[model samples]
Target chain A: MSASPGVWLAAIFTLAIYSFLYGDNPVYKFSEHLFVGLGAAHMAVMGWESMFNRAWTPLYTKGEWWWSGAIIGGIMLLTRWFRPIQWISRIPLGFMMGVAAGLSARSAIDSQFWRQIQSTVTMKLNTTNNIVYVVIVVCTLAYFLFAFNEKSGLGQGIKGVGLVGQYMMMIAFGASLGSTIMARLSLVIGRLDFLFKTWLGVLK
Target chain B: MKILRSSVPIWLGVFGGSIVLLAMFIKIPVHVGLWSKWFLEWRVILASFALTLGAGNLLRIHANRIRMKREAWMYSYVTIVALIGYTVLGILFKRTHPVYSFIFDNAYSPLSATVFSINAFYISSACYRAFRARNGHAAVLLLSGVIVMLGSVGIGYAIWPGFNTMTQWIMNYPNSAAMRGMNIGAALGIIGVSLRVIFGLERGHLGGE
Candidate 1:
């Protein structure tokens, strides 16, 4: 029912992608390649905009010499394409990695480790559900302990705890899988809704 | 050349990482904080360059394939044309152009959504093969999965009101516990690896010796 060119284009591409469900074919291949091309171009455009806004704009307009370092680092990254000057790329790579490592390590310590442990330990285990949660958490942590010798008494106890942890994790994974399937199914439904309602006018 | 090739990078990493790490804990004069902020910005700029590099690499590979007339070479032409065409359009008219927006909304958005939607079928087939209740653990996992899936939909409510309650309990308690445990383990691993990289003990990123 829709005469819009955009709607028509979308319908064709959507059907082409869905065609993969039957089997690999030229229609699917063409769509897939187009998707990759568009995706890469989008990324490059974003990168260019980011460089212009974050690095070039500051250096050019405000005369902030400090940002020149970033521009130099970015340009150095392109040297990776040239075989003779590939090693020059490592300087920027190292700088990026170092800063990332520092930031991640710091945040992981606070948010992932300390905050998580603090919250878990401080939880009031008054109810049966609360007790179960604490037990599961402790058991799951135990499962990851690889240093324990299973022959020792403490190790045997740990092994028992680890088994419970394994089961809990399996249940967790199953729940996650169910959640993922539902999310994907929702997307499929949305696509179908577009096809039926917007494109074909088959649904109210 | 040798120093530029190896030692300088290691020293730079050590200096940059140490300064950033120290700045977090030690707010030495106002300059340290400013320096750290600058470093963070530099990281973002460098990351943008990395994205561009990745795009360039993809272009190169596809261009090579087209040149060689390899299997499915015609598709490579489609890719290159689309890539170059979109990039040119974006650069010349900017992202706000009507044509650019039209292509993105109709072509890119639909393509991305359909690609992800197709995963629902694959995941269902995988679940069928893997969700067999051959043992107690498998049974537990399968039961949890079934409850969650059903409880999320209207049909499950019609089947049993208790399904929703069970789903909520599983997600809140057991799932949260497992995720917390995994997060802690992953955090420790990150700390260890990051420290190694910071100290130049992990030279793997430097590529071949």
Candidate 2:
């Protein structure tokens, strides 16, 4: 047992959530729901503070009342619950999605498309590695060319290249999956350490 | 009504999206050459408020459950109480409030971490079942995986001095090439989707009448 109430709460919640591994029960459900409620409430609190600082502060201190338009638009999101006025919700959703799309698309084009092609073409060192990289990239890109029928001779060649590309991808994915296991294992160890060391004080 | 249902939203998206898109290219010194700066802030402001949507939905769902006396309605009541309680404490005392921080530090932290860490057990079980080399491709993949995993740890380095070099070569050349190809394709896909949304073709996001 821990003297600190915070540690007790932490340990209890940790055990309760882990209890789900054994089987679903009321304790796990309580912990799960409690998490959801608390998480959302926390977000709301943070959002309110942020809005006050970013939107309201400017309007109050800097005399920029136009900032209120963003707040009003944001409040329209709650109209999602209203049946007749639900269409209004789309207004804000439209704004959010559009802004997000624009931001991502611009960055994606420059970073993902242009920058990658740029780097691949500029491989001036390590001649063997460069050639291998160029070949792998071209072949892997051929994997996405599904517009042509693979029954033709040229298409078959492309398909073969794509097959090699798939193998390369599988190798990468295997390394990724292996690393993912290790990462999750670290999380488990951290939690177990908290349980043993922090909660129970049984481990150094 | 048709205009309100679809056309309005589409144009709104295009208008909002175009603001940022154009800002990226064209430099307008409006508002002391900082209109774009404020527009970016507006984006954050808008998104912050949208965060409330999840809480709103949760409230309605659990409220309905409690109203109907559904199974485990007591849990729903617990959820509502927790939500209201935390929101009030958080709002009045700010996030740094001792009670709010206590709940977050203790309840939310442990619960979320435990939830995520629980995936480890299932993932290891899955790896055991999935890592079998039933074919040439599978064998190659598994071999690469084993080499990389072994090379990453001290024990494998102790066992074989070649593991690190082998893993580095595989990761740098073949893996990098493959990932670059996927990234380019995915970026093109993103541009395509963005254009669709801007053009009002991707109205699935808008739901229906």
Candidate 3:
């Protein structure tokens, strides 16, 4: 039994990519260059497609010349190249900044401030699981609270909370690190599996 | 002084932020949602342009390296060559062309794999150094990491069926809660940073305006 040409090609490419684990070599170098070239080309095409779809067609079809502002703005963004004309880029930059600021301002209340406060205040501690969560949250929040002194008075309560938060944060960070490690290991394992099944044809 | 007076970003940031804030609470169809969407779209467009700015910076830095004959000049040459080679090939041969695809398939894919593979070694070293069981929670973290690592490999399954269960429990319960909390905090920080930019406190993007 044999695989198709496409399968072989995929296997070869996979091997070529994985070869980099051995160190900097010809296969890795070749693959690296190819990736950059293709990625850049893909991005350019996508940009053009976006501009045509989002900006140009709407204007031509609906007689909405106002959309040309976007085009002009985009072109202005390119002016960062020319020394004297670099200032022109600021036009697009400013427009973008204005729009982003405006949008974020509108959404911040719902997404950031209000929602966070609501979630923070609305936790139920009736169940054992909920009690544990409440404790973690309270401790963590207290750990971050810089308003009180840690040495005395109400500061003692704050200090206790801070200690719990510190421990919880440490544990959380370690777990996060462990998960990230596992993910990388899985990728390597997948590559090895591909080597065996696809390249060597030993598995299947 | 004249330049300072005509600062466009500051005006845009302040006025735009205020308008957006006002628009958020408003029910008007014309002024609220569309305005925010338009702004987001513009930001995306601008972000694409910023990528070019980043590339230009990369080129300048590398070009300067070549000119100065810096240490490991050969690596710099290689970097410059690789960058220029890809740019030219894509421009000349059309991206979808077999030659361009060959470069992407053979060159880029391999490099990406190679970079990711380096993470394997780094993780090993980092875990070796950092996975000390100094406290009770630290001990749990260490044990969970060991299980997850083993389960991720084929060896954990060979050792015991329970490794998978333990890893799942650790991830679902403690890991998810912690990750969610961190993610929420990050979101808030990001929102704050964006707000600062909107209010003209961060003029770094304005190129020192």
For model 2, residues B1-209, the per-residue Cα lDDT tens digits are 87876777778788767766667677654542255456567878887877877788889999999999998888987788888899899888888888777777888888888888999999888877668988877777788788888878888899998998988888898888989988888888898888777665667788743
Query: Which pairs clash in model 2?
Result: none
lDDT scores in order: 0.89, 0.82, 0.64
Question: Could you tell me the lDDT of residue A88 within candidate 2?
Answer: 86
Query: In candidate 1, residue A40 scores what lDDT?
Result: 87
lDDT of 3 by residue, B97-129 (tens): 786676566555644664576687678788876
TM-score of chain B of 2: 0.87
Model 1 Cα interface RMS deviation (Å): 1.4
- Pairs with steric clashes in candidate 3: A17-B110, A30-B107, A31-B106, A31-B107, A31-B108, A32-B107, A34-B103, A34-B104, A35-B108
Tens digits of per-residue lDDT for model 1 on B19-80?
A: 77778788768777888889988988888989988988888999999899899998998898
Regions of candidate 2 where Cα sits further than 4 Å from its true position: B28-36, B69-71
Worst 10 residues of 2 chain B by lDDT: B28-37
Q: lDDT order of candidates, best first?
A: 1, 2, 3
Tens-digit per-residue lDDT, A34-80, candidate 2? 88788888888888888999899998899998788778887787787
DockQ of each: 0.76, 0.70, 0.35
Which consecutive 10 residues in model 3 chain A have the weakest lDDT in total?
A33-42
Q: Candidate 3, which segments miss by more than 4 Å at Cα?
A: A1-41, A60-62, A97-123, A147-152, A200-203, B1-6, B16-24, B71-96, B134-140, B147-173, B180-184, B207-209
